[model samples]
Target chain A: MTNEKNKKVVIVDYAMGNIFSVKLACQKVGICAIVSNDKKEISNASALILPGVGAFADAMATLEKLDLVRTIKEFIASGRPFLGICLGMQLLMSESEEFGLHKGLDIIKGRVVKFPAVNDKVPQVGWNQITKPSYSNINWEETLLKGLSEKDFMYFVHSFYVLPNNNNIVVSETNYAGLNYCSSLREKNIYACQFHPEKSGESGLLIYRNFYNLINK
Target chain B: MKNIRIIPRLDIKGPNLVKGIHLEGLRVLGSPEDFAEHYYNAGADELIYMDVVASLYGRNGLMDIIEKTAKKIFIPLTVGGGLRTLEDIKNVLRAGADKVSLNTIAIKNPNIILEASRRFGSSTIVVSIEAIKQNDGKYMAFIENARESTGVEVFSWAKKVEELGAGEILLTSVNNEGTGSGYDIELTRKVSELVSIPVIANGGAGELEDVVNVIKQGKADAVSLASMVHYDYVKKSMVNGSLLKNQAEGNIDFLKFGKISEKIETSGIEEIKFYLKDKGINCRK
Candidate 1:
């Protein structure tokens, strides 16, 4: 195993994500991470975190304008541990119907769609539970959710969720207003969650710690 | 579908954490940092820091406190009071607030809500509506710590804000605030029913049942409590002199004189969550 001091984490900044909170969370877990938009720095890091907040169309435009779309996709293709958060998670899908069909990174074969009109609010903003998907036998100990027990509550705030074409990639699912949707997925070295682990308190920190441990391994 | 959010609201005056009845008679509590950390450790779903006097000063002074709090706490933080323009909203969000609540400015220039929501995501813009029941049994929106009335009907303004792209609404009842009477279920339900976004019911929480009633009856997605939790934490731990030292900011007379208000009921975040869960209204544990 490589020395812990030698590992570096890069938080991709396309000027859209909540870079500060994610950086602070990394600092809390003893990981020296840098917030960068530089392709060279991002490609060289041991791990990458794509964090975002905003509309799908605008985010895609910003990512394309910064020329980070290719850099991010290549970084993942190189088999590095990558994590996507909130809107960052949505960008991994094929496209989003948020502001009228916008193309995504297409790393994961899926579509991002809005929550159906139900008795609940449009943006399901609150703490909700993430349970193991019935379709997969994946254990929490095997993924980025290392120490979290079943039904552990994580913070979520969004109007849309991902519908991955492959159920095997799904690690957890959450129900909101009678719609059971994929909340997080693990595809090879790629990990993404619709929830904001940086804002979920102690349980959230465990996620960063797990990612850090994975990098050191 | 989703668990109700239990938020601890801290009203700031100068540098001290203060509370007022009906949003008046400002009384000083201990350090905001101490109280905020305590709530976070005890499992507060979120936090709201309102600069109660910011409108009067014409500037929001929560940048320092927000920066300090954001570094340590890991929950969603919302800052309100005297945010006038897009620049003000950007500065506060950059200072580490997850969301900025607008009241006075949103009423004066409703377009700011649309503009800010466009610049930053809609989730970052929260419009706070301070309402008081009128003589005709209708609610009127007020601004400036509930001191000035906008003369706009509450229900209509709530709908307009949603259309303007605000992600959430923080609805406070001037009639019930700090009185420990309970939340204004009627006002909350009416506004929440009018908008599709999440509505956080603030003010008038005297007991655990009050928190329950707001979510169950008012149909509120969240509830913001100050006196109930603040008084409880102060009475149990703060009076010991271990947590609070007079920093010469705001009024510490209440702390020194051991004259913490007697009328306000007290409950911890843990206790509130337990009660809410027992009543079939789920909360983050």
Candidate 2:
């Protein structure tokens, strides 16, 4: 039986990230999300969404200052559905090379790295297609990208990308300026992507809908 | 190849969305929220909201409009004008803007570009350059609604901003802005070639071919349009009367009485994308 206890989706707000847009995206999909850094509120959430857009070191510093680093790690460890977008996804890595070398939450045993010097721009801004990974047997229908078509367009604005230690976690990959990289990943209860699904239009909304459905189920 | 983004730029005055020629002689279109929502639904790759008078008046008031639009529109929103400090950029981003464009202050004090890019991430900081082709064929950067000249050359400024860690550059050709003639190909090409960061070519998209030429010849990573798409959206809204709302803002008289001339050749976002695709130019589909 679904009750109020089972419906809470907490968007961890540690004074960074586009919290409003994430909250509004949830609202559009009929999931009321509370943007908070409160330990109790976040720990008690049925589902947690970690959304951010900024430097990795600064984001990690702020999360540490707000005392949310441990709270978030614990929340993910609890096996409740966890979602991370953009920088939030990168934070799941063990470390990132942005600005200077810095450690991450190490939730997924991955490393965040910058796009190698290429003919294209640094931050792969605007809409780019995400294709299902060929190496992984993971089905899109069983993850956050459940209803998205193969090679569907999603909005992206980032300078760095994540490299998971294990390929099994990666759900989708995107090609940018000849650099085919991991775009999204699904690992047990953890869902993360380098693109901002909230700003990805109809296909993006579907991602939120899928996450919402996952929470209730 | 990365898809070329087709961005619809809306210039705002007070409460209404306005359009002007060469960034002057403002004419109110309608509510920006209406246009933003229309473009978002119509499949715009991205949307740029420029507060034209915000810098001149010494205040930035797009927070409310951004908040209201961000509630419904599920696309990246770039807010520009009068963002003089990191606090202003932070507040706007908090209000739901994915990126903040700095023009006047970026030229006045270039250090802010470095500071903002570092603090907010380079991708979140966009440096918009308003360029006017001078007699010597050199593009000179302008500020304060193109009323004041910064006396700096556009090419150098583009490189400097990139060196300062700016993720992208919004290069608007004052010579071609709102004229519906075409983009300044030479100017766009020079800037795009000078910087590694993505350059969004703004102003002078009179037709679909103009859009294609800018990307193919000019090498612009994206195109920012105002008159071409704004007029088309306004014209269509006139027929359906769907974009009009009761709340009054800016100059609503255009929506009330003004008529879009037949000579105002325009194209929708989808049509532009289709045309770009037909020409073998990859755009958002």
Candidate 3:
């Protein structure tokens, strides 16, 4: 991996996400990240990171109002490294059923749904372990799951889980009170996860390092 | 299974970190950022900075402290005390607080909770209820750092706050606070059961057993501690009104507030987590 100086990563600011922590995480890994709502800065980024926290419908509305929908699509189509975290990841789905039926960015073939009321809490707050598949067509070892194990814990605080249309895109899964759900997904240059790697301590910092390495390569 | 959150709650008075017995007779500890750094290194799951005098003093003074600490501490930080408006919430969030806990303003204007939650996510908003056990054996909510009683029942208020879109409920027992007695198990259990959102039991935690009891028996998703962790590291730190006089006399420099000593023999968060884990509590190792 190249330790390129002044490597710029753009965090798409639609005015909803936890952009502070994400930018700090990038700084921890020696990458300079700029949180920009401007389309030009986003399109010109070496790598794009979309970090979001809040309701899915409200986020979509902000993105629509800011007119970032097409710019994001074209950036992803360019095959540059891109990452979506938490609500940012949820917005990649075709639609979400949070509160009511609302549309998403549709970068990935999936729909966001609320966690089933199965005797457990609605929002699975706190640290939970992620399980990787034994075998898969995608190189799980080479992707964002690099240098990590199944027992590694990630911080998650959300009531909804994603159901992707294709299983091949799923890189890992986590089980919450007997209900297994998709935790991380990857499609070509795009990467997304339901968990917050920025808030997950040292193990989390490794994921950002891996992403930086991928972009640098 | 979800891991239980272990939070070190630091009560701040202006720049110095202070703790009181049942929220009175405030004693000055050193800088909050120092204690925050110590806790972060000790493997604390999260940290809470409560401006104890914010409501009474009419200003939240932890913005600069939070901004400095958030740069170093990567864990989630929840800031509470005197957050009365949407602009206040926005300012705290901009200063790098992961979540803002509302107590006085939430009870005064319930719409602030709705508006804050609507603007920021529900997860970013927490309703901190200071509960005191009444003579009839039921808990009543208090405000202004447990000085005034709202007379609203704990269970009903918790449900209402959840309905108002609070992501979590921080239930503190004023009767049990700083006394090292124990957390109010019955109150925590009732509030936790009444709401689908997470409930954090704060106030009294003297021993590992107190932490275990609150989570295992009381069903608290998280625990916020002050005296349990604070007293462990400082010597003769408990102040009874006279320290405030010394502070006001300009004889005491808060930077060199108290002598450092280890009163509690445990190895901090690691030991606590290990003790809890041995007792079959699933905590993050």
**Stretch of 10 with least lDDT, candidate 2 chain B:** B242-251
Question: Per-residue lDDT of B15-134 in model 3, one digit per residue for the tens?
Answer: 878877788877776678877888877778888999988855645357888898888887889999988889998888888888999999998898898998888889999999999998
Q: What TM-score applies to chain A of candidate 1?
A: 0.97
* Candidate 1 lDDT by residue in tens digits, A3-122: 566598999888774778898889888888998999899988899999988899999999899999999999999999999999999999999999799999999999999998886788
Range of the 10 consecutive residues with the lowest summed lDDT in candidate 3 chain A? A132-141
- Which of the numbered candidates is closest to the native, going by highest TM-score? 1
- Model 2, range B1-285, lDDT digits (tens) per residue? 488998999988877788988898888888889899999989998899998888555343578898898888999899997778889998888888888899999999999999888777788889999999999887899988788998999898899999998989999999888887889999999999888889999988888888889999999999998888998887777786765664365556667775654445888888888888999998778
TM-score (all chains, Cα) for each model: 0.96, 0.94, 0.92
Stretches off by above 4 angstroms in model 3 are: A1-4, A134-140, B56-61, B235-267
Q: List the residue pairs that clash in candidate 3.
A: none
RMSD in angstroms, all models? Answer: 1.9, 2.3, 4.0
Error of 1 at B17 (Å): 0.8
For model 3, the docking class works out as medium
Q: Taking the tens digit of each residue's C-alpha lDDT, what string does model 3 give over A30-68?
A: 877899989998888888999999999889999999999
What DockQ results do all the predictions give, each relative to the true complex?
0.72, 0.65, 0.67
